[model samples]
Target: MSLRTSLTAFPRQALSRPNWRQTVKTSLVNYGDQRCGMAATAHPVTQDSTGSKGPTAMVFLNMGGPSTTQEVGDFLSRLFADGDLIPLGRLQSYLGPLISRRRTPKIEKQYADIGGGSPIRKWSEYQCAEMCKILDKISPESAPHKPYVAFRYANPLTEQMYTQLLDDGFGRGKGGRAVAFTQYPQYSCSTTGSSLNELWKWRNRLEGKRANGGKEGEGAIQWSVIDRWPTHESLVEAFARNIEEQLATYPEERRNDVVLLFSAHSLPMSVINRGDPYAAEVAATVHAVMQRLNFTNPYRLCWQSQVGPSAWLGAQTSDTVQNYVKKGHADLLLIPIAFTSDHIETLYELDKEVIHEANSPGVKRVESLNGNPIFIKGLADIAAAHMRSGQTCSRQMTLRCQGCTSERCLEQKKFFAGPELSSLVR
Candidate 1:
C-alpha cells in the first residue's frame, strides 16, 4: 500500500477530542500566570539592596510544534511563511499557505500517532521551571528566575511571551534582565537564529517606543542570549550518562559492540552551503558525548527529517540503520544528539516509523533527555554561567555566517551583542 493509504489505516486517536484546540488555548492562558505565582511564592524576588538581580526573566526559545492536531495548520503555515527557514521569496505569501494547507493532514496524522499532539510544550515548561528553581539556589544574584517559553510556530509565541514579561514588570521601563536561552543545544540559522530574529522583530514592535516617545530601548528588558552550548561539560556529561544507561540494558558482552548512531534533524544543503554552523556544532556535540564515554563504542553521526526533494546533510538516519542491519550490525543504539526533549521526531519518527520499519530487536533508541535531572541541572549551569559572565551573547553569535546576507541577521546581532561586539560581525 502507498504511504497515504497506510496513514489512513492508522488509528485517528486525535479525532476523539474535537475540542482539543479550545482545551489547549485555555490551558496556555493559565499556564504562565500559574507558573509565575508558584515561582514568586517559592523564590520571592528580593530587592537589589541584597545584591540580587531578582525576578530575572528566563525566556526559553525554540521552534515549537503544535500541541494539538487542530494547531498543525497554523504551525505549518507560520513555519512555511518564515523566510529565514524556507525562503520562498516573493511568492511566499501565496505559496506558503498553500503548501501548509496541503501538508497539514499528513503532519497531523504524525502528531496523532504521537499521542494527539506534541509534548514539547509540556517538556519545555517543566524544564524551564525546574531549571529556574535550580538557578534561584545557585545564582542568587539572578534569583527568583521567572520561566517563560517562546515557541517560533506554536502558542505562547514570542509576542505573547514578551507581553507576559512586560506584564510581569520585567521591561517597559522596569529595566530587568532577561535571557533568551535557546533550547537548541546547537545553533542553527533556521532554528535558534530564526527564533532570535522573530524575537528581535517583536521587541521592536512592542517595546520599541516609550510612552513619552523616548529612545527605542529606553528601560526595555535588557536582553542577552545563551546562543550555543554544544560542547559544554555539563551537557556532555548528561548525554553520556543517558547513553551509558541505555547501554546498560544490553547484555554485558554485547554492550561494547553496540554501534552508537547519533542522529540529528537534517538541514537542506542550501542552508549548509550558506555556511551555516549547525552541522559542525552538531558534530561537536556528538564528539563531546563520545569522548565522555571514552570511545567505548563505535559511532557515526547521521541526519534525519529531510522535507521535500531537496538535498540535505546526511547519511540519513533511516538509510544508515537499514544498511547497518543488512551488514549484520543490528546492535545499534540511536541517540538523538541535537534536541533536548521528546517530540514527534522522537515519538513517531524514531519510535513508530524508523524502528518499526527496521523490525530489528537490536535497533533501539536512547531515552530523550526529557525531565532528566542531570540534563535539567546542565541547563541551570549554562544559565547561571551566562548570568554571571555579563556578556550579552556568545562571541560566536556576533559573527554572521560566511555567506549570510540577511539584514535581519545583522540588526538582531547588533541589538543583542551591543555596539562593542557588533563591530565584529562583518
Candidate 2:
C-alpha cells in the first residue's frame, strides 16, 4: 500500500487492538534505544550520481530545554535574551541577564522535581530518526535523509546543527537541500519564526557570500521549510487516540461528562495583539482533535506557563482548573495540545503545580505524543508531502504579521522562500 493509504487505514487498525496502550509502550521501548543509538553516530552522506535526490538533511527545530539541572541557568539566559520570544527591546542586554540569573535557582528546582532535566532531547532524537527512516522508504527521491536536532535555547543549537551538516558533507561548496522542519505544530513568530531567524543568521555567518553570492538554489544547502502542520489528519488522530485512552480510565457514565481542558503554552497578550497565528492554530488543533473524538466530551482551550505577569492570554489553565473544581465539576482531563512532547511545562507546571494544587483525582493529564508511532508516521507523511510539492515554505509562512516591525522577520522569510520570494511575499 502507498503511504497515504496506510495512514488512512491506521486508525482502524489501531482501534482493533484490545491493549493498545501496552502495545504502543512495548514498541516504544524496542524502538527508542535503536533510533537514539543511530542519532548519536555520524554517518557520511554520498549523493547518487544516477539522478537521485538522496542525502537530504532533515533538521528538526524547537525551543529545547536543559538536559540537566546544571544547564538550567544557560537555558533561561538564552531564553530571556531572545528578542523574538520575549522582546525586552533596549533593556534586553541589561534586564535579560539580570532576570535569567534571578530565576535560575527557582527553575533549577523545578527541573529537579521533574527528574534531573527535560526528556525533550531524548524524544526529539528518537522521533526525527524514526521519521527519516520512514521517509527513506516512502519518499525515495529524498532518500538517505539525515536527522539533525537544532534547539534554540539548549545544546545541539542551530549553529551547532548547521556546522554538523557541513562536517557531514552537506553544504560546504557541494550543493544539497536541507529542510528546516519546525517541531511546533502551530505557526508562531515567537517559536518557529525565532528558530528560522537564528538559522538564517548562522547560515550567513558560517556559509558567507561565497557560493553564488549567498543566493539560494546555487551552491549552498538549498533550504526549504516544513513550517507548520497544526491540523494534519495524523496529528489529529494521535491526539484523539490519546484522549480516548484517558477517557477509558474513568467510569463509563462519567466519561461523557468529563471536561476536556486543552492547554497550551501561554503567549503574552502583546504578542497575540501583534497578530501572531499561534493561538488560532492551537485552537484549530483542538477543534480537529475534538471532531475526531466525535465531540463526546465538553472541552475548552486554556493557556499555561505565563511568566513575568505582563498580561498573558487566558483563561489560564491553572485558574480554569481551580474554578471548575470549586464549582463541583471535578472531572477534567488536561491535554497539553500545543506540545508534542513532555517537558517542564507538562511535567512540572501542569502536573506538579496545577494538578497538585487542585488536590483532586479527576484533574489528570493526557500523555504527551512523545515517540507515538502514529505521530511519527504523521510527521513523515507531512515531510513527504512537502518534498513532493517542491515548495520552499508554506504559503502561510510568507506573510508577516500585520504588527511585525522586525527586519529580521522580513529577511528570514525572504531567505527561506528564495527565488519565489517575490511571488510569496505579501
Candidate 3:
C-alpha cells in the first residue's frame, strides 16, 4: 500500500516468451500472495454462468516527459510530431523535426532546472500503485483493479501498455474490459483525446491477433474512457484543501487579503479555433474549487506554458502576476488548477520563472496534488464512480463542452454507450 514500494521487476522470461498473460502472472507472483501490494494482484470482473471474476485492466494516460537530459529532444520530437498537439496539416512531416530540434536547448534548460528531467512518470507510477490499494478496499467484490501506465509522448508509451494489458487477458473474453483513465483533471483534444486515439489505433491493429487471428470480439478489449472530471466534487475538495493549507502560511488576518491566481497550461489559439475545450474546462475547475472553499478573496484564472511566439490562452500567468502586483495586491497565492502533479511546468515555469518575475514578498506557489491523501482519495472516488455505474467519459455528470468538436471524442462516446458496453451496466 506504500507509494514508495517499487513494482517488482518482471521476470526475463515474461518478455522473452510470446505468452503475455503468463508473463504478467509470473510478474504478479513475485509480489507474494497478498492482494494489497502490487497492481497485478487484482483480477478482471465478468458476468458469466461460471461465476469466475473477469479481469479488468485500468490504464492511466498522460503527457509523458523526458526522464533524462539525453531524452529531452526525443520527447520534444515526439510531442511536436503529433498532429494532435501541433496541427501542421501536410507540413507536419517537414516542420516537426525542425521545431522539435529548435526548441530542445531551451526546453532542456528548463528540465535541468527541475533536477535534470521531469518526475511526471515517477509520480504517475506511484499514484497508480496507491490507487490499486484503494480500489481493493472500496470494491472488494469486483474484479481486482490492476493499474497500468500509458504515456502519449515518451517511455511506457500507449502501445506498450495496451499490448501488455491485452496479453494479461483483459478485454480478451466476453466478460473482459479495459478502462482508459486520463490523468488530466480536465479534458482537451490535444491531451486526453490524442492519447485515446493512439490507444484505439493500437487496439484496432492488434485486435484478435493475440488470441485468435482476425476474429470478431476475439482478443478485443471492451474499452471505457474516463475522459474528463473538471467538476468532480472530490477533486474540487482536494484543490480547495491544498489551497487552504497554503493560505495557512499567511497571518490569519492577512489571509483574506491574498489574491488567488489559478494557473493552467496554455494551448495555441489554433487549437481553440479548432474547437478544443481546454480553456473552458480549466475555468470550470477553478470555479468549482473556489466554490468548494466558498472563497471571498479576489481570484483570477490565467494560463502558462506558452512555447514559441504563437498566441495562446490568456492572460499569461506571469503577466497576470505582474498585473496583480501593479494593482497593489501584495499577497498572491498561485494555484495550479490544470495540473494534478508537479512537473516541469510547476517546478520550473511557475516556481522559478513566475516567482522571480513576481518579486513580491507575499507571492507563493501551492504544491500540486501529488500523493496528497485527500487527492488520492478523490482519484479512488473517480475510479469507484466508473466501476459502480459502468460509465465512462463523464456523460452522466456534464455534457460535452459547447466548444468541443472533436470527432475522436464523439466517436468514443458513441462506442462507449453502444450494445458492446451494455453488458457492463450494473
Predicted structure with the largest TM-score when compared to the true one = 2
Write model 2 residue lDDT over 1-426, tens digit each, in one string: 243574763566674435555655676676665656843545577555222776788999999999999999999999999988897879999999999999999999999999999999988887888899888888888888989999999998999999988888887778788889999999999999999999998888778554346553335688899999999988898898889989999999899999999999989888999999999999999999999899999999999988885889999999999999999999999999999899999999999999999999999999899877788988998898998898998888999998998888887898888786645765
Model 1 stretches astray by more than 4 angstroms? 1-51, 209-214
lDDT of 3: 0.74
Q: Write model 3 residue lDDT over 292-320, tens digit each, in one string.
A: 78876789998888876767878999998
| C-alpha local distance difference test of each model | 0.84, 0.87, 0.74
Candidates ranked, most accurate by TM-score first: 2, 1, 3
lDDT measured at residue 269 in model 3 versus the true structure, 0 to 100: 90
The Cα error of candidate 3 at residue 258, in Å, is 0.8
Count clashes in each candidate, considering only residues at least 3 apart in sequence or on different chains: 0, 0, 7
Tens digit per residue, CA lDDT, model 1, 1-426: 222222232233431223433533555456666756743453323334243676688999998899999999999999999977877779989989999999999999999888899989988997898788778777888777889999999998999998888877776677888899999999999999999999998988888753336557678788899999999876786688678878998999999999999999998888999999999999999998988899999999999998777788999999999999999997899999998989988999899988989889999998887766556767887898888888999999998999999898998998889767888876
The stretch of ten residues in a row with the least summed lDDT in candidate 2 is: 209-218
User: By the TM-score metric, which is better: model 2 or model 3?
Assistant: 2
Stretches of candidate 2 above 4 Å error? 1-4, 8-42, 49-51, 210-218
Better of 1 and 3 by TM-score: 1
Comparing candidate 1 with candidate 2, which one achieves the higher lDDT? 2
The root-mean-square deviation over C-alpha atoms between each candidate and the true structure, in angstroms, is 10.0, 2.7, 9.5
- On the 0 to 100 scale, the lDDT of residue 59 in model 3 is 80
